[model samples]
Target: MDKFILILANSQSHFINVIRISIFIVMVWIGGLKAFQYEADGIVPFVANSPVMSFFYNKKAPEYTTYKNPEGKTVQNNIDWHKENGTYIFSYGLGTVIVLIGTLTLLGIWFKKIGLIGGLLTFGMSLVTLSFLITTPEVYVPNLGGDFPTPQFGFPYLSGAGRLVLKDVIMLAAGLICASDCAQQIIKSKNSISVNRAKF
Candidate 1:
């Protein structure tokens, strides 16, 4: 475990590329599960809140309505957007771009240009996830119609909007780490190329 942590902490270009690939694969797997409601895994928060959950609950085409905010305003959850817009559209549109860029980084193909695009995509996801983690609870959970809504899990740490939000923050941090590493590698590669040309 120490060795594993040390490798990740070193945070080199190759290591960061591995991180990007791993994150994307996990995202894709989660999205696929969201696309098809398999068994519920407690680790996945979005899937639990999905319209697909209604199926698990034995409903006939149940609509996913989000909990209202403290201000009594309705909001759309992430699963709602995924269902309405179509998972493939969201996946290929944003997901494919990120994955392709990440794959390119790992392959060392067009490192500077592709890495820039990958870093940008990762940064954008980081920002979007950060917003979801921060703003959505204030806008949705208060409307669950209770002094205090029941947590998703039995334990405090395992349940509650705060815990879900914390997970998103963790994902955002991972994206940022990937982006920073890619950007640094891009710059370093450019410098190396220039140095090689100068030597020639």
Candidate 2:
């Protein structure tokens, strides 16, 4: 056990590198999906509920409230309007930014400065995703009738989609770790350069 622990400790940096690469791959995959119409429709509720993001839709339009289909059933029309108003364009732009961050992170394997920038960007993106927990009420369990005293106005309980957003916390920590590693590398390189200059 002691020998195994020693080996693991020695390879800690390698493990961190693996985690960094894994995060980059996740970003690239999800970012690519955002360009599609299905993904644009899927993100509608999250964007509509967000105070910081609600303006993306045209609120004054007749379709903003509800639309009656040919069958005469009223349905929320945001999805249709979102599609028409270039939601896919917005999604594509977001995807591009995400891909750029991942690309910079991958480049960090060769350049510490670029890696540090990528790490910072990743951390910022994590914070944005995590913020949805506060702004998105859909994440919480709906109020279902039960007993008189026990109103099922779910607060602490997370829905399936909420759980997905929660994973950003882990990503945030990983970004911090990657940034710290890059900072250390930068300091070490500077010291080495200074020492070589002194020798000359």
Candidate 3:
């Protein structure tokens, strides 16, 4: 038991690396999906309602509600509307950024500077995503009238979208951990250089 405890205590660095790889896998996979029409359309509510991102869309929020397309299902009218709204274009740009961040984060295994940038970027992205819970009305279950009182519909009750966005909290923490590790590495490298210089 003592030996096992010691082993686990010394594995923090390895575990942190694992977290970095995990973030990479998740970012790349989701980012790649953004290329699809369905994926592009699905993010309408979040982007349209976002105060920071709304400028990317031609159409406004609430207007997006009427044009919402079910995932993996398509309507010509909806597709046309999305095109006019720059949904696909924005999605492509966002996807590219996400993939690049992931690649940089993964490269942290070999290079600290790039890793630090990636880590901070990931944190920023996660913060934006989590903000959707507040900005996007679709994140919570609507008060759809039922025979009985819909007690579960409201702010405390999260919709599927909200739940999905909530998962970003983990990514937020992982980003900080990765950033801290990279920062430590950079400082250590600088200190080594200083020591060598003093010896000369």
Candidate 4:
């Protein structure tokens, strides 16, 4: 058991690298999807409702409520509205940033400085995404009338979108951990250099 514990304890660096790679894969895959019209249209609710992000759109909130393009289906009018709203353009830009961050994070295994930046950026991006839980009404189950007064519809009740956004909390933690690790490596490298100089 002691040996096992020692091995586990020594594996922290390896685990951190694993996390970096995991984040890289997720970011690249999701970001690449942003190039498609379907993915661009899917993010409409969160982006449109965001106070900090809404400026990217040509139209305002509530107006977007009328143009939502649910996955697996598309309407010409909805696509036209989204095109006019700068949805695709913003998505393309955001996607590029995400992919770059992933690449930077993956490079952390060899380049601590770049990895630190990537980790910090990942944290910031996750922070913004998690905020959608607060900014997006679609994150919660709506009180659609049914046979009975839907017992589960409100803030705490997570819809599919809410679940997706909530997962970013994990990403947020991973980013911070990776960033701190990189920063530690940088400081250690500087200290080693200073010590070597003193010995000369």
By TM-score rank, best first, the candidates go 3, 4, 2, 1
- Provide the global lDDT of candidate 3 against the true structure: 0.93
TM-score of each: 0.49, 0.85, 0.97, 0.96
lDDT (C-alpha, whole model) for all candidates: 0.47, 0.77, 0.93, 0.94
Residue-wise C-alpha lDDT for candidate 2, range 63-175, written one tens digit per residue:
32253232223235744665566566778888899999988777777798998999889999899888889987767877776677965566777887688889999989888
Better of 2 and 3 by TM-score: 3
Candidate 4 all-Cα RMSD: 1.3
- Please list the Cα RMSD from the true structure of every candidate, rounded to 1 decimal place: 9.9, 4.2, 1.1, 1.3
Best by lDDT: 4
Clash pairs detected, candidate 3: none
Poorly placed runs, candidate 2 (over 4 Å) = 60-79, 146-149
Query: Across residues 135-177, which tens digit of lDDT does each residue of candidate 1 receive?
Result: 3322234433445565432223333555544565555666667
Least accurate 10 contiguous residues by lDDT in model 2 = 65-74
Looking at model 3, report the run of 10 residues with the lowest lDDT sum.
Answer: 145-154
Off by over 4 Å in 4: 147-150
Between candidates 3 and 4, the TM-score winner? 3
Listed per model in order, the count of residue pairs whose N, CA or C atoms clash below 3 Å is 1, 0, 0, 0
The number of the candidate with the highest TM-score is: 3
Candidate closer to the true structure by lDDT (higher is better), 1 or 4: 4
Worst 10 residues of 4 by lDDT: 145-154
